[model samples]
Target: KRVGEDLNRHVTTDGSKAEWDAQDVGLMNQVNFDESTMPIPLCSCTGVPRQCYKWGNGGWQSSCCTTTLSLYPLPQMPNKRHARMGGRKMSGSVFTRLLSRLAADGHDLSIPLDLKNYWAKHGTNRYITIK
Candidate 1:
């Protein structure tokens, strides 16, 4: 959720680059088959240690990662039209950066391209203009 929302990696506090390993992300980060998200601490920031990335959240998950639904407040299966996410035009956006990292990690992105909308309907948003 944080990644899709463009938040920093290992981000303890919201909207900051502060990297922390403590399980203090509150209730928002945890989910079933979390390994699917590959939440490894791939950082080499000034204060972070290299060895720290070797472990944490490690285990074997038999759960079908994609079949698993979302987290908290309201959990539901992905929409029926659920398909891979793609960018209209690639740039330095967080979405692209995440995709880049995934690709760099040797992920097979075969035919993983599609055009899509660029709008959002955030939960905190209340003013949806009606036509």
Candidate 2:
């Protein structure tokens, strides 16, 4: 059974120092796009004549044909949210596994050097000391 009132109930609108200041706290808005009207760019190619020659007052004849190309920007893919985190909480087991994997991948799990030194010097245990 839930012990306390919903956390949302405690939220206050009064802009005060003591009150919890909650701003920009909500699910990320989804991106909207109009698919039908959006134009998809196309690629096109054309052939051009090179080295034209005139023979006996006849129309010029082309020796070789050069290819002309037109390239257009690709259309943007519709944005999609893979997973929605609304009102969902991560279990402790999942959190532990994530942290363990991160640590195995060389992520730092040690305390800061300055804090470690301070604790070594002034902490309750006398045996601990920084080398």
lDDT of candidates 1 onward, in order? 0.27, 0.25
Locate the minimum summed-lDDT window of 10 residues in model 2: 112-121
Pull out the clashing pairs in model 2: none
1-131: candidate 1 lDDT, tens digit per residue: 64478554544664333432332433343322233453422212222322111111332111111122221212222442332222112122333333444455565444232212111112221111111
- Superposed Cα deviation of residue 31, candidate 2 (Å): 37
Clashes per candidate, residues 3 or more apart or on different chains: 0, 0
Error of 1 at 20 (Å): 10
